[model samples]
Target: MRGKYIALLVAAVLAAAAAGVGTAYVRQAGRPTAKTVLPTHEDMQSFVQTANDWITERQKTADLSLYMADTQNGWRSDGQNLFHTTDGGKSWDAAAPFYDGGAADFLDATHAFALAKAVHDEEALTGISVYATADSGKNWRHLALSGAPYFSAEGITRGVDGFSMASSSNGLLILAGDPAAGSHESVVFATKDGARSFTKQADSLRMPNGQNTLALADASHAYLFINGSAAPVFMLATTDGGKTWKEQDSGLSPRFTDVVPTYVPVRMAADARVAMLSVQNGTPAAGAKGKTETADARMRDVFYTLSPDGSVAGKLTELLTDLPLDAKSVSMPDAQTIYALSRAGGKPVLYRFQAQGGWKRVESATLPADALQLQFVSLSDGFVLQKDAVFVTTDGGKTWVKRPL
Candidate 1:
C-alpha cells in the first residue's frame, strides 16, 4: 500500500558507502551509551550504514531478498529460497522456491509475483519474464505475457534495466540500450493479467528519459517516476488500471535565478492525490559553460506537497537548510497525520505534521536516531525496523518496546 522499502533503504546503503566505513565498526559505535545520551550526526550515519549492510549481508547469506510481515504472518524470499512465518516473524518455515533474482510483489499470504529477464539461447536476454506462486512460495510458474514489448530484433539487444510489479498480475518493465552506451531513450510495457499478458506503454516517454521506477496504489491506480541526469523529473499516473496513463505536470517553477528545478518524489500518500517531493536547484559551475555544476551550496533541503492535478497546495518547508542531511522516510498515517525523519546537524530528527502547523519536531529521550525503516499499521501501532532489532510503539513513538525478529 505504501511505497516499497527498497526506495529509502537504498539511500541509507549509499550513505554508508559514501561515508567510507565498514559495517563492523559502524555497528559497534551505534550502541547507545550512558555517557552519550544523544547520538551525533556521524554516529547516526554509522548506525544507518551498519544496519543497511547487516540486512544486505543477511539476505545474501540466508538467500533471501526481502522480509514482509503483518501482525500474524511474514514472508521472505531470495529467488532461490523461500520462507514464511505464522507467528509474527518469530520463526519461519522453508518452502520449495524458484530463483529469478528479480523484482517481486506480494498481494497476500498465498499469492506472490515477480518480473525477471527472459533469456533465449541460454545467453541472450530476449524479453521480460513473469513468474508467480499461489501457495506462499511453495512452488512457482512462469506465466506467458501477451503484449510485452521487445527490443531484440536482428542483432540488437535492448535489456530490461528496470522493472516493477504492482499486483499479482499488473506491472511495468523498461527496455533500453546498453548501460554503457549513454542512451536517453526507453520503452515501457504494462501487464494487467498477472503477467499472463502485457501492453507496450510507450517507445519513448521523454524528458525524465531513461531510468524509472513505479509506485502503485492498486491494480488500477499506479504512477511511474522517472529519473534522468540532465532532465527535469517527470511523473505519469494511470487511474483506469494500466490501460492509459497521463503525465502529472509538475508545476515546479524555480523562484531563484541562475538555477533550474529538480524535483524528486519522496513519498506518495494513500489517496494518491497528495505527495511529498524533494526540491533542489542546480546552477552551472564556473568554467563549465553551464554543462557541469555541483549542487548549489546554497540549495536548501526543501520539500513540497502537491496534488496529482499539479497544484502546489502546501507551503514549501525547509529543514536544516544550512546542513546537508536529507530525508529518509515520510509516512502519512491518515489524511492529517504525517511523520518524517531526516538527518540534520549530524543527527536524525523526527517531525510531525499538523493541519494548520506545518511540521514540528518530536522530542523524546527514547527516540531512536538510527532507524532504517518505519511501518505504521495504524495511528497508534507502528514498527521501526533498525539494523540490529525492531521496535514497536503503541503511544505514537512516545515509548517503544524492542521486538525480536
Candidate 2:
C-alpha cells in the first residue's frame, strides 16, 4: 500500500508542471529590427545611486529582507554586486564583496551569509569562502576554506555542478555540493561558529552514485534528491543539523532528467512540513535507452507536496504539459503559488499558478538581452539581474521597474 501510494504521488507531481504542445516560432529573413533603447552610462549611474539611497532609507526599519544576486556574469562574482531591498524591493542597496553562487540566507534584517568561490590560475575551486555580515550590508567578513572543494566554482567549471546553502542557525551552516569527479560523493558541510570553522557531513547520508540535489526545511531538516543512477533515492530528513541524514521514499522512477534546488522551503508556514519540486523527463520507457533520439521529444513533470514523517503528502498536483523547451527556473512562493520562468517567443515569460486559478500566463517586463537569471523573492516581489543592474517588481510581477545597483 505504501509503495502504491508513493507511485501515485510521484506520477501526480511529475504530471503537474508539464507543458502542452504548442506552435513553435518562425522568424522571417530580412525582417527590419526595432531600434534598441539602451540606458546611458550617466543614466545608469544615477539610477544605481537612487536605488542605494532608497535602500538606506528603508534599512531604518524593516522586519525581513530579500537580496538578489546580479546575474550579468552568469551569476558569477567578478562584476556583480548583491542588490538588496527591504521595503518590498522599491529601493536597493549593494552588499559587500562576495562570491556569486546561488547560496544566501538572511537570519535577520541585519545578518546574512553568502557562499562564494575564489578564482586563481583560471581555476575556481582553489578558494571557497562564505561571507557573513552582521550589520546588514555595511561590513563583510570572509571565511575561506582550504583544500580543493567541489561545486565551489561559479558556473560550469568542469568539477562540480551546483553548490547551495541548505540551512543556517546559531553559527552553524550547511552547504550542499555536487562534485563531478567523485561519484557517490556528493558533499555537504556543517560549520560551527558562524562558518569560521567547518566539518564534513557527507557521509551521514547514503547518496546515490551520480549527482544529488538538496533543499532544506530549516536549520535542522533537509531533503536530497539523487539522480543519474539506476534508481533515484531521496534523503527526506537530516538531523544533527544536516550532519547526518535518513532516507525517505521519493516515489520517483529511478530515472530523472533535471533537478533544481530552492531555499524557499525555509519560509514555509510550518517548518516541519517542507516542500521541493522536481521536473522529471518523461520520455516513454522504450526510447529511454538511446542517447540521441531519446533526448528529443522529452516531456516534463512538475511535482510539489510536503515532505514530512519520512514521506510526501498533500496530493501530487499536475500543473502543465510539454513545458518550455529550455525552462531554467521554477519557484514556489508558497504551497499554493508557483512561478515558472522560461523563454517563449524569443522573450522571457512568467507563468503563475494558484491553488484555485490553475495556470495563468502573464507578460514579463522587457529585460536586457544579457539578463539571464530570474528569482521570485516573494509572492509579491521578484527580481531579474542584467549585467550590473537589477530590476525588481513589488506588485506580484505585473510591472517590473528597474532598481539600479
Candidate 3:
C-alpha cells in the first residue's frame, strides 16, 4: 500500500448513520429502507489527502518508543526506562527504569507486575526479582516468589520464558528451554492469590517446542499453542485457571509428511468458542551432518475454529490460502475478524480477514516495514508493534493513531 492513499474510517460513521435511518424508516413506513449506498473507489480516494497530511505531521514528531497498548492504557520502554499512559495515549509519564532485561504485565492503571533479571548475580545465572506496583505506576515493591524455574538435574537456573496476567489475582509464568541442556520441555506456574504464591500446574508439559505462546481470555479460560515438530501441534486449553487442561484436537491432519506444520494460536474468544490459528508449513532442510532436518519457515495459511462456549471441541476451517510467502504475523481479536501483516513485492502489506469473506487488502497509510506484534483489546480496539513504536486502531484497521514514547 502507498502512504499517499486515504483511509476510510469515514465508512464507520456511514454505517452507523445507515443503521439509524434504516431503523426509523422501518418504524414509520412499516417497511425497511433501501440498501445503503456504497462509497465508490473515487470517493475512498478522496480521503487520501486527509490521511497523508495526518501521517506527515505524525512522522515529523514521532518518537517511536511506545511499545504496548490496551483499551485504556499504553506502555513504553526505552533501553533502560519504562513509561505509561492511562488516558488513551494522550500523555505519558516515566514509571521506573529496568537495568538489564525484563518483561511486565500491566493489567490496568492501578495494578502491574514486572520481572527483571539481576545484573551482577554470577552464582545464579537466571536470578530474577519480581516487582509489583499498586499505586498506578507511581510506586513499586519487591514481591517474594515462592519458587522459580530452577532445575537441579541441569544445574542451571532458567529465567521466565513467558509471562501473562489475567487479573490482579491471577497470572501464569512459563519457563521453557535450558541454557545448558537445550531441552524442548515447558513448565507452567500458576498464581491465584495475586503474586503471593506460585505452584507448578502438573507434570512437565511436553511440546514440539520451537516457540510457544499462551493466551488467557480471563482468569478462567486460556489456551496454549506449542509449535510441534513433525508431529501434530498441541493446542491445550484450561477452563479452571491452570489447575486442569485438555489438549484440543484441531481436526487438521494428524501428521504431515510433506510439510512440517507449526501452529500459532492467534486469539481465543472470552467465551472460548471462537479461536484462530496461523499455520506455517515448510520443507525440512538437511542439517550440517545430514543426520537431522530443520523446519524454520514462513506462514502458509490462516485457519479458525468455532465450537460451543468454553469447549475445546471445534471444527477447523482454512480462511486465507493466498497469502504472501513472507506473511509473518496474524492476530484475531474475535472469531470473525483478523489483521495479518506480510510483505508483497518486497514491500509491506496488511490484510484483513473476515468470516465468510476470505481476505481483503487494507490500503490506508503504510505501516512500518517491521510491524509484527499485534494485540487486540476487543474486536475494534487493537495495537500493532512496529520497529520502534506502537500503532493503535480503535475502529478495527480502517485508520490508526500513533502514540510515540
Candidate 4:
C-alpha cells in the first residue's frame, strides 16, 4: 500500500510538472549589489516611534484606524502596523489590529480583518474578539456574532491560529486552537450586515493530536491540517459555514513527527476552487545503532497535496528528497505562481515555480553575515529581516537595498 501510494504521488507530481502548472524560471543578470537608497536615521526613528506608539495605544484603548499604502508613503500594511513596500522599503505606516486584538490581515487595501484573542497569560478566559475594516483600513468595527462561544477559565482557549474573509462582503471566518490544554479546534463565524453582527455556524473541530495551521479560501470554504498520532491528516471542505467538514482522501500521506507524533502544516494555500497543503515529516533512520544515537539523527521529507474543488484530486508530490531540513517557507502569490524559501547547503536560497514547471533558483547576492529569516513578499520582491535592519529586494532579489527600522 505504501508503494502504491508513493507511485501515485510521483505520477501526480510529474503530471503537474508536465502540465506546466508550476514550472517557471528567471535568471540573474549582474553582480548583486545593494542600492544606496537606505532609510535615513530620521526615518528609522520615526518608524520605531510609530510602531511603539501603536502597540502602546492598542494595549491601552484597543481603538485605532487601520490604514495601508497612503499615497504619501508607499507603505502596505500586512496587518495593523506591519508594513511592506515594493518600491524599496523607503517609508512605513500603521494599520488596524487583528480580529483577536493582535494584528490585522491585509488581503489587499480595501478588504482586511483582525484576529483578537481574549487570553490572560497562557489561559484563554472568555470571549473571542473579531474586527473588520473596509475603506482601506480607514475605520473598523466589531463583528458581532450570534452565540459566539464565550470562553471562561473552564472552557478551552480559542487562540487565533488563522483567519479568512471574503472580498465581496464583510463575511469573516477564524480558526483558533488551545495548545496549552492540548486542544486543537476551529470555529466559523460570518457577518453579513457589515461588521456589526456575526452568526456562529459550527462547533470547534477536534483533531487527533492538534492542529498546526489553518487556511480559509473564502467565507464558505476552509481547510485544516491536523497532526495525527503517526501522520498528518487533512480536513477539507467546511461547507455550511464550517459547521461540518469532510476528510479529503488525496492518497497522500503527510510527514510524521516522532517527538510527540505531531504533524505541522508548514504552508497552505487555496483559491476559489482548489487548496494545497505542504507537510513535513521527521523520522529516525533505520541504520543507526542505538535508540539514543538513532533518535539524535533523523531524516525528513516534505510533500505536497492538492484538493480540486475542495476534494482530493491526486496523490502527493515529494518536492524535496531525504535530507537534513532546517526551515522551509512557501508563498503563493497567485494561483499559478509559488515561491519557496529554504536553506540549502547551509545558506538561505529562494526558488520559484509556475504551474507545470519545476523549481528554479531565484538568484540573489549573498546576504550579510548571519542574515536569515528571508521573506518573499511577492514574485518580484522579497526581504530579509535582520537584527540591525530589514533588507529589501525589488528585481527578483538580484539586487537588494537596506531599510533600517
Q: List RMSD in Å for every model shown.
A: 9.5, 14.5, 14.7, 14.4
Each prediction's Cα lDDT score? 0.49, 0.42, 0.49, 0.41
Judged by whole-model lDDT over C-alpha atoms, candidate 1 comes out at 0.49
True-vs-predicted CA distance for residue 97, candidate 1, Å = 3.8
Error of 2 at 113 (Å): 1.8
Q: Rank the candidate models, highest TM-score first.
A: 1, 3, 4, 2
Give, for candidate 4, the lowest lDDT window spanning 10 residues: 1-10
Better candidate by TM-score, 2 or 3: 3
Model 2 per-residue lDDT tens digits across residues 157-250: 3222223333334323333334444343435566646666666666323345443334444455555544334343334456556666676655
Candidate 4, residue 273: CA error in Å?
A: 6.6
Writing each residue's lDDT as its tens digit, candidate 4 over 288-320 gives 322122111112233344453355553233344
Tens-place lDDT digits, model 3, residues 1-405? 000000110001001001001011001111114543333435323333332332243333222333333576766544356677777655768787642335566555567677776534556445556677877678877754423443444534355545667677877776664533334556667888777767777436555433345656667666665542323445677777666767776545421122223444444445334444433222222342311322212224535453422344543344333222111255555556667766565466767777687678877674655553455556677666665556778776667887653
Q: Give the top-scoring candidate (TM-score).
A: 1
Candidates 1 and 4, the one with greater lDDT: 1
Model 4 regions more than 4 Å off: 1-88, 97-103, 117-125, 144-158, 168-187, 209-211, 227-236, 250-305, 315-318, 321-328, 366-378
Compared with the true structure, model 2 gives a TM-score of: 0.57
